[model samples]
Target: MTAAQRGRRVLVLERANKVGKKILMSGGGRCNFTNHFVSAENFISANEHFCKAALSRYSQWDFIAMVERYGIPYEERKHSQLFCLSSAKDILNMLLDECSDAGVEIRSHCELTSVSALDHDNSRYQLKGHQNQTPLQLACQSLVVASGGLSIPTLGGSGIGYDIATQFGLAVTKKQAGLVPFMFSDASKALCERLSGLAVEVEVSCNNTLFRENLLFTHRGMSGPVMLQISNYWNPGDTLSINLLPDTDIIQWLQELKQQQPRSLLRSGINQKLSKSLTSELQALWWPEEADKPLAEFSDRRLSEIAQKLAAWQLKPSGTEGYRTAEVTRGGVDTAAISSKTMETKHQPGLYFIGEILDVTGWLGGFNFQWAWSSGYSAGLNV
Candidate 1:
């Protein structure tokens, strides 16, 4: 929009039959467009400070203003994340309306099979591909590679972005699934299967990082906001420390429960705090020796041990579910190879990279979309 406002002709090429398929699916169709407090601290990148300039220049407030201008109703959710009150289609339509108003021509189903230098003497890019099975070729001076990253393949996520960066001699970093679920080994899978579909608010910690959100137990493994958030820092063989009871002081709470309900069975007493099924699972795992015993029968030392175990239960996941279920990818074109201020290639002129195509990956919620707006806005101002 900025480029068109500055009188530069703009054209957008979309490989999908429709633009913003992913956007339409974000936040359960009600798109989480931005967060109330978005900063460099909320993002992860190879060069940590690479996102400061663009994010500051085009903050969440700017995007909110656009949303308001379009009269798109929105609501604020947990963690200051904002979501559309109606549907994600509203945001997509607003963007399309803006592009149309600015005279930006959008050509959908224009997949570029190959992008290479037109000639050594000229600084133009020759794009070749078939649009609707018709021979398609184009030449342009300024090229913006916003092809996105590899995550959900059905959502048009692929490695084309990295391929383009490498083709242009730009450094592409190691990419991995971020905001994804974890899978357990065969031995541990049975536990998750038994607790499948059970969701509880808990703090899941790994690699000295902690996420206080809901952890959902799936038939295959674990998911939900907490697991997805911590997965960004998790690696193979890393053990996660989960605090099942974050709000209660387990030791003191256990003693009080035991004192108040001396004749009650440990399972029965615990069932009051947790679900009966979860309490059974915990008793089977933590206090198998005294699971059936009454609270009065348990010694102080034994109660302490159980409390300690519940407070910091450790588990090592076999691996993640991979990009098939990931929300966003971890890495992309190296930030060191791009100019932070303009999102332009330092070595290759007229070539800009933005959004998921870059190394910047935001946390769960609306951070990623905010990066898309910020980086895209930055590139627009310069390109």
Candidate 2:
């Protein structure tokens, strides 16, 4: 759109028959296009400050204004994450409409095979690939690879972008699954399986980072916002400390409840604070050999131990669901080789890498899409 607006011919090569498959699937179809609040703090990148310039140049307010210009109704969700009030189609359509106005030619089902410099001076780029099942090639003064990262392979997420960076003699970083669920360790697998489908508001922490959000139990492992957020900072063999009852002082609550309901069974009193199913599972896991007795009969030390366990329950995850379910990848082309201001490689002029192809990975919100817009626009202005 920027190239065409500048009176330059523009072409958009898409590998899919449709242009916005991922956009349509984002935010459960509502499409969290951008966030009301965004800053360098929201992203994770090898060069930590690389995203600042582009983001500042094309801020979230810029995109929101554009959405408003197109009359697309949107709503602000949790943490200022903005979603289309109607559907993701609205955002996609707005993009398409802008491209149309700019006379941008969109060729769908275009798969790139190779890219090489046309001249020794790197005057132009030669792009050879198949377009709609037909062989095609291009010679352009500039090339922008926004091929995204390895996340949802079903949606065409792969290492193609990293492959391109490697082909260009640039450094690519180690990549891993990000914003993914955690698989349970052997010791916790059975309990997680038994409590599958149960959800609790929890504060989960790992590596000095913490997130308070919903924690969901799955047959395979643990998931939900809190788990997903903490997974980004977790490594293999790391144990996550979780507070199931983050809202209350568990020790005091239990002591008071025991004083008032001395005749109540331990499970029953705990059940008052948690679900019956969860209480039963906890009893089996924490005190399996012990008999279910009145709260008055249990020793203070036993209650203290139970309280401490609930306050800082520690569990190590086995692994993750991998790219199949991850929202984005952890690493990509090293930012040290690229220019933060223009999204262009310093070693290779006229060649740009934007969006998820870069090492910048945002939090699980609309931050990723915002990076795309900001970085793409930065390259567009320069290209």
Candidate 3:
């Protein structure tokens, strides 16, 4: 029934009016809650095993089972991303319903004033927030910090997750916005602006890591699936390489075209594999003068050089869109001090950290929400 009915105490503090605000907006309204391709390696954490324990305890199949229970029709898209037949609200309702079933009390619109441990043992916590008339005080045997990270502030993202950890003598890793769009500098901004609305399938590289997907050009900067994937690894002033032609051996393709059509324009030869707008933009960037040159006039060495340039077009991003537009936060509460099996703080008993608040962050797609499901279940079951 209610908290009073069950005689079990619980308090879930939600800063915004909407508890699952981000959950509603994710995956273009259909929540990609979890994926079939899940492993400890897919996540980044201070202690890799921290996620392994929880994830193994509550696997992707567990969430899928719950989804099946709700009878939410779903389909597997590319990369094993599962989308709801309707909207993300179904997933949110499922979670809320589960929490209710467990006799969990969700306190919405309640801004946490402060959190501190009660005694030397640090077994109990004191939580302060405004209630019906005045500031209210809450003492609990356990405190679970699932407040999330500082991404999409409009969606109730906050550092409140970190604050609780810090107050309890826990370590928090450096945080940053990730899986967000990249913005170019003023000089390069003009080119990106000029090519706005043009999207092409390409391979994007940031240092040793590379991602192959569709890249979109925006008036402000770069986005789309590929760019968003690479943005997680991109840092300020770091060089990024874009392969304009992903699958084609540009030189060989052009050589054959040159023999077939001796008077063909250089742009036309490249356009056979690439979009005309993208080909024009790349040709302007690579060989502006040769944009009008006949393919027959090009030598093998020149073609090879063009191929190299096309395969690797490097540019350094000035910065990213930051937490406001970030899909998920990069860092959070360090996992070293927390128990991997239980998600409980080692030093502070009954103190737990789960979801995006912890250091574990997953790649784009359904990974992050998977972390939430696994980690949340771990804490919920154990606590």
Local distance difference test values of all predictions, in order: 0.89, 0.88, 0.83
lDDT of 2 by residue, 109-158 (tens): 88889888767443478889998779989888888888888889878776
Model 1 quality (TM-score): 0.97
What does candidate 1's lDDT look like per residue over 1-383, in tens digits?
77777777888888889889889999999999999999898998989999999999999999999999989999999999999999999999999888888999888877788988765434478888877788788777778989888899888888888988999999998888999999998666888999999999998888878889999999889999999999999888899999989999999988998899998888887777788888888888888888678899988999999988788988999999999999999989999989999998998888899999899999998999999999999999998
lDDT, candidate 2, residue 314? 89
Better of 1 and 3 by TM-score: 1
**What digit string (tens of lDDT, one per residue) describes model 3 on residues 198-296?**
888999998688889888999888999889888877778789998988888777887888899989988887777788887777787788988778888
Cα shift from native, residue 174, model 1 (Å): 1.3
Which candidate achieves the best TM-score against the true structure? 1
lDDT of 2 at 90: 96
Which residue runs of candidate 3 sit more than 4 Å off their true CA positions?
1-8, 120-123, 131-134
RMSD values for the candidates in order, in angstroms, are 1.5, 1.7, 2.4
TM accuracy, model 2: 0.95
Best by lDDT: 1
